[model samples]
Target: MSDAPVRTLLLWCPDWPVLAAEIVDGVPATGPVAVLHANRVVACSERARAEGVRRGLRKREAQGRCPQLTVVDYDPGRDARAFEPVVAAVEELVAGVEVVRPGACALTARGPSRYFGGEEAAAERIVEHVAQACVVESQVGIADGVFAAGLAARTGRIVPPGETPEFLAGLPVEALGRPALADLLRRLGVRSLGDFAALPAGDVLARFGFDGALAHRLAAGRDHRPLAVRQPPADLTVTAEYDEPIDRVDAAAFAARALAEQLHDRLAGHGLACTRLGIEAVTAHGQELHRVWRHDGLLTAAAIADRVRWQLDGWLTGSSRRGGGGPARPTSGIIRLRLVPDGVIAQAGLQAGLWGETGEERERAHRALSRVQGILGPEAVLTAVLGGGRSPADEVRLVPWGDERLPARPGPPPLPVARDTTAAGGGEVADGRAAGRRRGGGSASSGAAGAGRGGAAPPWPGRLPPPAPAVVLPSPLAATVHDADGEPVVVSARLAVSAAPARLTVGTAPPTEIVGWTGPWPVDERWWAPAEARRRARFQVSLADGAALLLAVEAGRWLVEAIYD
Candidate 1:
C-alpha cells in the first residue's frame, strides 16, 4: 500500500431510511420522520433530531418529545437502494467511490480535488451536483482520513493538517462508533472522545476490550480501514425504468429476465459471479418495493429472473397484509424497476464439473428448490428441526424456509427415528417399522426394531396426513381425538406427518387409521408455571396394516401427531 494520506473524502446522507421512505411515498420532505427498530429509535431526520427526538430514545419517550414525528419501519435495503443514485453521482465526480454503509461512501479526492483546485472546492462541487440531482439533503467532509472526514461532515467543521486530535476532542465519546466503549466512558464520567483518548492505551484496552484500542486510534483521527479497492467492481447489473407503471407480474418478470441476461453476460465477460442481487420496483403512485436475495454459488441469469419474480409475487400476494385492513395496496402499475448486483467474487472454480460429493451440489440443489418454492409459496416446503421439550410433539419443530429456523433445543440425542417412527416418552425411538420401510429394509432397521420394542416407531411413508385443522378457524386447533375404540392416544407434540413413505407433499390429505399402538407417554411442560399452566399427554396406536402409530392425547383430545413406518 502507498504511504499516502489516501486522499479520501467521505459523504454521508443523513437519515437515509427515512429519506428513502419519503422518496418512495412521494411524500413532501417536510416535518420530522424517524425509523424504528423494535422499540428503540434507530435513525431520525435532522428535522426530528432538532425537535429533540434522537436515536436510541424509547418510542414513547421520542413521541412525547416530537409528537409530529412520522415513524416508519427501518429497512436497510431500502436505504441502500435509495443511495444508488447518490453513489453513481459521486462516482462520476471521482475516479472511484466505495459504499461504506447504506448512507455513506468514501472516495479518493486527490485527483478530483487537484483538478477542481482544492479539497474544499472539490467537496463543494460534489455536494452541489447531488443536491441538483435529487431532493436528498446531505453533508460532505474532506480530511486526510475517513475518521476525520466523517467527523468533519457531521459537524461541518474543517480540521487543518495535524489538527485531527483537537477536532475530535470536543466530540462525544459516542462518535467513536463503538457502543461498549461509549457506555463504559459514560459510566466513568468521560463524555468526550478526547477524554478517553487521553487515557493510557494499555489501561483502556484492559478495561474496555478491543473497543478501547479502536477508540484510541479513531480519536487520533487515524483510520486503518483501507479504501477496499481502487477500481469499480465487475458485476454490473442492468435495470430499466418504464415510462408507465406496469401492474402485470408476467411483464415485470419478463423485463426483469431481460435485464438479468444482460447482467450475466457482463459477469461472464469479467469471469465473475454475483452472489448477491437486489431488485427495486417503483409503483405507479410512487410506492417503492425492493428485495435483496443471495445465491450460495454462481447465480445464473435465469435464477436472477426467478428471484425478481418471487419478490413481486410476494408483494402481489399481499404477504404484507397481516390484519384485516390497513392501507390500500400499491398499484402494480410499476414505474421503474432496477436490478443491482451487490458484490462479486471470482467464478474461476465455479465451472469445475463433478458437482457431486463437493459442497457445491447441495448449495445448487438448495438454490433450485428455493426458486421453485418461492414461486409456489414458502409453506410448500419445510425443513425438519430437532429439539427436546416436555411435549414429545414439541421436541421437533418444522419451519418453512426463509423464516426463522427453529433452533435446536438441547435435550435427548436424536431418536434415530424420523416422522414415520414413533418417539416414546423422553423422545426415545420406540418403534421398529421406521415408518413406511419394510422391517428388513436397511441399516436403520436394527435401530428401529430396538426403538419399536420400547414403544417408539420409525416415521411411516406414503400415509397422507389430514391438513392440520384450525379448531377455531385460522388459529391452530389443539383438539383431542379419542380413537374409534375410545382408547386414549397420545400424539407427538410436533405435528409432523410423513407419507406412508416419508416423501414431502403439498396440500392436505386424510389421516389414516393406526395399525399398531406403542406409547402412553406423559409430557409436562411449563413446570415452573402455575399448575394450570402445565400440560400432560399419553400416546400409542396401531393401524390396520400392522403399522404402529404414535399418538398423543393431551388436554382430553386424541390427535394423530406422528406415525411409525
Candidate 2:
C-alpha cells in the first residue's frame, strides 16, 4: 500500500542504441555514429554528440553537422539482443532485477547495500560485474525511487535518503518524457520539475489526464514500482521440442519464431503483453542455458523471436558471455526451446485501431501523415466516406484527414427489392446487379448504424441494389458498350435502351464480347441546375474473358464505372 518509490539501484548504459548497433551490427562504437528513425536522430554516439549532432536533429541536419557520421537505422530488436547479456549478467549479482528498458535495469538496494557493506559498494559491484561479464560499460546510481534513480544514473550520482525531491527539482520539465506537456509547461512558466510539481495534484489530473498526473507524481518524488505490485501469470510459458537438434543459426531462428508466436498467442488470450521475457534452451548434453530480455514497450512477437535467435546464436557459437562469470557455451545442439514471461501487464494504451492495427502502429501512421501535411497542405491528405447517392463516385466523398467523417448527402432513399441478374444463355452475367454493400445494407459491421447523418439517417433516391463492386474508379474511364448488330447501345431520355449490350471496350483495349447484361437503371439528379444535372443509365455486364464491370451511359457516351473481382 505504500505510495513511495522503493530505495532502488539503477544501471544505465550511455548511448546504448549506438552500442547495440556496434554489438549486433559490427558498427564501431567509438565512431561518430547516429541512429536515425523517422528522418530524425534517435540517439548519437559520444563522438557524434561532440560533433554537434544531438538527438531529435533532422537526419539531414545531423549529417550536415557531422559529415563523416555513420548513419544507422534504429532497431529495437538489435538493442534488446545486445542488452540481453547485460541483464543476465546483472541478475547473477543481484536479485529482483527489473529491466527498465534494453539499456538500463533496476533492483531494490536495501538487500544489496547491506550484503555488499554499503549502497556505493553495491553500485560499484554491479558496474564491475556487468563490465566483466558482458564487456559492456555502465553507470550506477542509488536513490529512493526508480524515476530519480534513472536520472541519477546519467551522472553516476547517489541521492541521499529523503532528498530525492531536491535532486529532481532543478531538472527540466522535459525529463518527464511528454514532449507536448513539457512544451505547454514551459510556455506557462513551469520550466522545471519543481515548478510543475507545485501545482495542485487534482488540477494536474483534470487538465493533463492520467499520464500527466503520473509525471507529476514522479516530479514530486512519489515514484511507485509497478513490477513489485503484481504477480504475472505462471502458466504462460511456451515451449517447443524438436526431433533434430538446432545447431545452425537459421534452424534456431525457425524454432524461435514458432515458440515466439505461441507465447504471444497465449498472452493475447489473456489480454496481456510481456515486458520481461525469460528464454531457456536445453542442449543435447543436458546443459541448460537461459537469458532474460526486456523492453520499455510491450515485446511484440518479432522482438521476442529476435532475442531468442540472438541468445541461441551466442550459445551455439560459444559466445555465451565474454567473461568467466557468465554461462558456459553449450557443448551440443539445442534440443528444446522455452519462453517464459517474467513481467506481464494488461494490453492497455495499445488496443487495436479502426483498421485492426495496434495503437503504436496507428500513432506512427498518424505522425507520418501529420508530417506530410505539415510539409504540404492539410488538404493534400484525404479520407473517403460512403454517402447517399445513386452512383459510386457520388456515394463517396473525400474529406481532409482528421476531419469529422460525415457524408455530404443524407441517408439513402427507399430502395427497390434486389432481383437476380442471372439470365440463361446471357453469357455468364453477374449473379446480381446490385450496388454497394447490399444496397441499404444493415449498418456496416465496423461502423454499424449512425454512419450517415446524426439522427434518423436521410435517404438516397434511385440508389442501386447490393453486391458492390470490388473497385470503383475515381474518374469513370471512357468506354463503349455495343449490341451484337455492331450498333452502339444507347439510353434515351425516356429511359429506354436501343439494344442489349453484347460487347465492351475499355480505354484503348480492343472490344471484348459481353455474355450477359443488366440494368438501364436510370438516375436524373440536380435537374434544377443545368451545369450539375446528370442523367445516366447504369449496367452490369459480364465479358468473355470472365471479367465483370459496372457501366454507365450518359449523353450517348458509355463509361466504365467500376470492376468486380
Candidate 3:
C-alpha cells in the first residue's frame, strides 16, 4: 500500500530441484535427470532438456523421450534444505534477505546497492558469494517490486528506477505465475503484461476476484500488498522434547507431523498462515541444526511437516564434513525438534455455502489421503489425471493423491462410441464406455497395462475408432479366430478379413459362436523402429453371450486385446 515502490533484488538458482537432489543423493550432474511431482516433470537437468524432456511432461513420456533420464521424486524440503546454505551466503553480503522459495530470494536493494557501488555490482557480489559458498549457478536482478524483480532475475537484468512497468509491459502474461489466468488472458487477446494492465481494474476484479487483482497489480509493476515486514510472535514456536533419542527418519517424521499440526492450529486461531518457517533440531551430543524455508505462497500443515522431515533427514543423515565432501550420517540421535513461524500473513476466512458444507468433505479427504501416505509411502496413494495421447491408455496420467495435479493436455481426436455391429452405421457407443476405457487402461485390476506407457503418440493416422473396450488386457491373450470350416481366419495387408462369420476360442476355452463382426482396422505403429515396429489389424466381434470383444491380428496370429463388459 506504500505509494513508492520498493526496490528489490532477487537471486535465482536454475534447476534447483535437480541440484538439490544431486547434492543430497549424490546423482551425477552430467547425467540426464528430472524431478517429478505427481508424475509430471517439475524440473529437469540440461541434458534431459536437450533430450526433449521439459517441466509438465508426464513421467512415462519423459522416459520414453530420454531413455537414460534418471527420475527423482520431488521433495520441497530437500530443495529448501539445500538452498539454506545459499541463503546464508547471501545474508553474509546483505541483510534483510527474504527467501521467495527454495531456488530464489529477494531483499531490499537500497543498502546493498549503495554499499557495493550499484545494483548490478551488489547482484554480482551476491551471485559470486553464493557460487563460492554453494558451488551452484545463480542469477540476480533488481526491479521496483518483488514480482518484477523475480521476473528480472530470470533474465539477469537490472531495471532502472521507475521503469519496472515499462520493462514488465513487453513480457508475456505468464510472468504472473497464475497459469489459469494467463491462459484465459491469452484467449481473450491479452497476450502481454501491457495488455493485461490496460484492462479496467474493476472488470478484472469482477471477473477474476482477489487473485486476479493481485496479479493485475503485479503486472502493472505495483506491489500487491504493502511491504510491511513484521516479526512472528515469540510464542508461536512449537517444540517437542523426546524422552528417547530418535535417530531414524521415520521417528523424526512422526514427531514432525504432530508438531506441524500444532503449529497450524495455533496460526489458524489467529487467522494467519506461515510464509516462512524455521526448523531447529538438537542432537543428543549437543550439536544443533537449524534451517529456514520460505514459500512465495502460504504453507499448509502438510507442507510444513514435509520441510521438517527433510531438514531432519539432512541433519541426521548428512555428512559431518563442512569442506564440500559427501554427507555422513549423524553421530547422535535427535533429542529435540522445534518449528518457528518466521513469517506469517493474514489468511482470509472461508465463506460457508448455503448448506454449510463449505469444503469440509474435501479437507477430510485430504487428511485421510495424507494419513494413507504416511502409512504407506508417498507413491502408494495416487490420483489419475487425463493428458495428451492417442490411445485411451496414453491419455490417462497418475500422480500422488496430495500433490498438485498436472493439467491435462489436449489429447488426440475424441474416440468414437462403441455401437452394436447390428446397429446401422454404428451408432455412438455409451458414454460409460469412454470413461471405462480411460479408467480401465490403468486401473489396479489391469496390472501394468495402465502403467502410463501404452498410449499412442498424437497424430496417429491409423488409430482405431473408440467405443474403447471397458477392459483392456495388460498383455494380449493368444486366441484363435476360425472360419465356418474350422480353418484359421487371416487378415491381409490390405486389411481385408480372409474369412469372418465364424467361431472364437480363447486360451483353450470352449469355442463360442460369433454373432456379428466388423471390418479389421489396420494400425502401423512405430514403423520407424524396425525392431519395435508393429503392424496389426483390429476387429470388434459380437458373440453369442451378448458380449463384445476387441480382437487384434499380428504376425498372422489372433489375440484378445480387450473386452466390453
Candidate 4:
C-alpha cells in the first residue's frame, strides 16, 4: 500500500441535524429551528441563524434570538436514519463508503475520478445523483485526505494534488474539530492551522501529547489514517422471536429495549462498542423490514433501544420518509426483531469513574429499575426531592424516578447567624414567666440559593440547620408535654411557655422524663391568609432513654413531629 495520502471524496450535508428532525420527526425545517443537547444549541437552520441563533448558544439565548424557533432535542438516530438513503444513493454510484458521521461520508476519489473522467466530473456527478435519488442537497470535495476533503466539501472546492497543506493553512484551528486543543492554541496566539503547523513536530508531540500530535499531523495535511474500518463480527448480532406479534407501540418499545440490551451485552463481551447498528424486523405477513442507524459516538443500550423504538414507530405508523426507509408500512404486526452491529470499534476512553460515578453495579441497578418501570409503568418508581420549606413534609416532593431533581420553590437567601447566650442554641423554655429570652437568628442556608439549577446559594431565612431528622412522621403523633407540677404546659399568645417541660408522653406510651430541652421557637406561616394561617411553637428535646424528638404545640395540642436517628 502507498504511504502517501489517498485522494478522498467527501460529501457534506448542510444543517443535516435540523433536516433530520424534519424528515424523521416531522418537525418543519423551513422555519426557524434549533437542535439542542444539554441545553446548548448543536445546530440551527438558516432562519434561526438569520435571527442571530448560533451553535453553542444556550437554549434560552437561542429562543430569545428567535422567539418562534422550533426547538428539538438532538437525536443522533434521526440524523442517521434520515441520512441512510443518501448513503445508499452514493453507494449506487460508487463502491465502499465510510460514514464519518450522520451528516458526512467519505470514499476514495481514485476510482470515481478515473471512471468519471476527472475529479471535478466525479464530484458533480455524485452531488447531482444524491440530490436526484435522495432529494437532499449535498456538496462534494476532493482532496489528499479525509480531513482535508471534509473541510473542502464545505465550499465544494477541490484541493489540487499535494496542495492540501496550503489549502488548510489559512483555515482557523477550530477546523481540526478539537475544541479544547483549539482553545488552548488560540490562547497561545496560534490562531490559524498555518501557525499550528509551523510549530516544531517534536515540541507539539511533547506539549500536546499523542492526540495533539495526531491533530498536528492533520493540520499539516498528513491525515494518513486509512479507511480500513473493521467489519463487526457476526456473533455480535442478537435476535428475539415472539409468538404474539407486537402491535402496540408500548409493546414494541418493551421488546426493543430487551433486544437492544442483548445486542449491547454481546458487543460488550467482545470488548467493543457499536457506532452503527442495523435493525431488522419480520412482520406476521412475512414482510422483512431492515434499516441502519448511525451515531457519532458509541451507542449505549438506551440509545440503541430508542432508535429501535423510533424505527418501529415509523414503520408501524407508515411515517413518511424523504429517503432511506421510505414510507413503506409493514403488512402486519412485527413477530420478530433482530439487531446487527454494523459498525464497531475497540472500546476506548470509557471506564468506571475513579469515584464510582458508573460501574457494573450501577449498570445492573439501572437495568433493574428500567425493567420495573416497563412492567409497572414509568410512574411506579418515585424519588424524593428536597427543596425550600419550613417543615419536613413541605421540604420534600416525590417525583417519578429519573426526572430532574429540582426544588419546587426556590429557597430564600441565607440569613446571618446569631447565637443565643443562655441555651444550647436557644434558651431553655420553662413553665412560669421565662427567666431568659432567646431570639433565634437566621439558620445558615445549606445552599445560598437553595440549590437552584444554577448553584446559587440564596439562603432560606430561619431554615432549620442540618442533622436533619432521620424519620419525619407521616402524621404527627398526638402527644403531651407537662411540667414538674404535672400540668399541661401551655404556650401563650406571645410565645411564652406555661412552664419548663419536664416530661413528654406520646400516644399510649408512659411519660418519659425530659433530660434536656430547647426552644419555644415560634413558627407562623401564611400570616396573610386568615383561613390558612398556622402558629406553632417547636422544641427539640432529648429523652432520659437517649432518644431525641422534634415536638410542636399548635392549638394547645402537643405532637411528636419527627424523630432523630
Best by lDDT: 4
lDDT winner between candidates 1 and 4 = 4
Sorted on TM-score, best first, the list reads 1, 4, 2, 3
Model 3, 374-449: lDDT tens per residue?
A: 4343465887776654344655678876455674665554544444433321332233331211111121222211
For candidate 3, what is the TM-score?
A: 0.47
Select the stronger candidate by TM-score from 1 and 3: 1
lDDT of 2 by residue, 381-445 (tens): 78888877666767788976655679998655344444434442254444544322211222122
Alpha carbon deviation, residue 150, candidate 1 (Å)? 0.8
Model 4, TM vs. native: 0.52
Which segments of model 3 are wrong by more than 4 Å? 1-243, 246-261, 267-413, 416-464, 483-487, 508-510, 527-531
Which ranking of candidates, highest lDDT first? Answer: 4, 2, 3, 1
Pitting candidate 1 against candidate 2, the one with the higher TM-score is 1
Q: How many clashing pairs does model 4 include?
A: 17
Per-candidate Cα lDDT values, in order, are 0.62, 0.77, 0.75, 0.78
TM-score of each: 0.58, 0.51, 0.47, 0.52
Off by over 4 Å in 4: 1-6, 23-25, 36-42, 52-65, 72-102, 105-137, 170-192, 195-217, 224-440, 443-542, 545-565
lDDT of 1 at 76: 82
